[model samples]
Target: MRGELTAKGRATRQRIIEGAAAVLRERGAALATLDDIMARTGTSKGQLFHYFPAGKDELLVAVAQFEADQVLEDQQPYLGCLDSWEAWQQWRDVVIERYEAQGDECPLGSLFFQIGRSTPGTRAIVIELLRQWQESLAAGVRALQGAGLVPADVDADIRAAALLAAIQGGVSILLSTGRSTHLRAALDQGIADLRGTSHAAV
Candidate 1:
């Protein structure tokens, strides 16, 4: 069950969440405080609680959801439409550039690690993000198959899953090593394998 908020109330809450997310990204989740969010969002303690109700832990979960949403939103139209090899390549470059620019700071990942994924809300947010991401990749593979670029018998789900796993592995490595090489290699190999399938079918 959720509390119903007015339009203005919703806007204020979202402002707080976005502000909190920015603060968390700038200053690691472990160090960010409620007062920091207060100053960032121009909200007082009462207003913050009026919106969040359950204190900082609750606000943290909201911020986690915001960050998770950003992970997909940052990819934009490239991730949405991957029908062609050119589109896939563009998407790959975007992924690499995004992570490289982001460096070791992953707001969502940090939040999960700090709070623990065992928290039901945090677990759901991550699970949903991956599911949606994988589905988008699957859709792209199916589009290629439809266009005769990929063999009709190819399994879009499995290919998409493998590619998605490769990306996650590369991103994990980048987070640890601060280099985009693994991300680039994984993407290149995944795309090349897909291309190979096309040639094999031909």
Candidate 2:
């Protein structure tokens, strides 16, 4: 059922999801239970069911969406703008710092693993997240072109896609081996190569 919740209702719902995400992050999605979430959020079972009629699955999906947003939101104003080399470097630092701080506790990845392939909604959430992230990167690339930092002939979409892949690969390795060296290398080299294009075109 679609919720036409009041302003207060929306806040309460958001609180539940955020609290659930915290529980998942701390306890791991595989082990977290609805009771744990309720305790964390200070919500009763009835209140939880009111917001999530489908119970655990519905709530978990909500948490998944929350985690997806956080993946990008953590980068903040830096990701929103890449008008200069300095800005890009700041963004790269933010990315590395965010992931390193997160360490092996990948909230989104853990959510995906817990849900597995049973729910198509989870897959859709992931796809949308990647699309949005790539689009942001592409916009940054275009900004460089507009400023003549990157040659106009350079393919923004391709560059963004490749950069996104490199970041994802680095993140995977970080999760597996608990290291950020690959991530830093990928970002530094990718940005340097982009900067090189500016020199080559001149």
Candidate 2 at residue 53, lDDT? 92
Tens digit of lDDT per residue, candidate 1, span 1-202?
1358888888889999999998998999999999999999999999999988889989999999888888899998999999999999999989998999988877888999878879998999989999999999999999999889999988999999999999999999998999878889999999999889978778
Candidate 1 lDDT score relative to the true structure: 0.91
Per-residue lDDT over 1-202 for candidate 2, one digit per residue giving the tens place of the 0 to 100 score: 4468888889999999999998999999999999999999999999999999999988888999999999899998999998889999999999999999989878899888888855799999988999999999999999999998899999999999999999999999999999999999999999999999988789
Candidate 2's displacement at residue 202, Å, is 0.6
Q: Count clashes in each candidate, considering only residues at least 3 apart in sequence or on different chains.
A: 0, 0
User: Which 10 residues in a row give candidate 2 its minimum summed lDDT?
Assistant: 1-10
Which portions of model 2 miss their true places by more than 4 Å? Answer: none
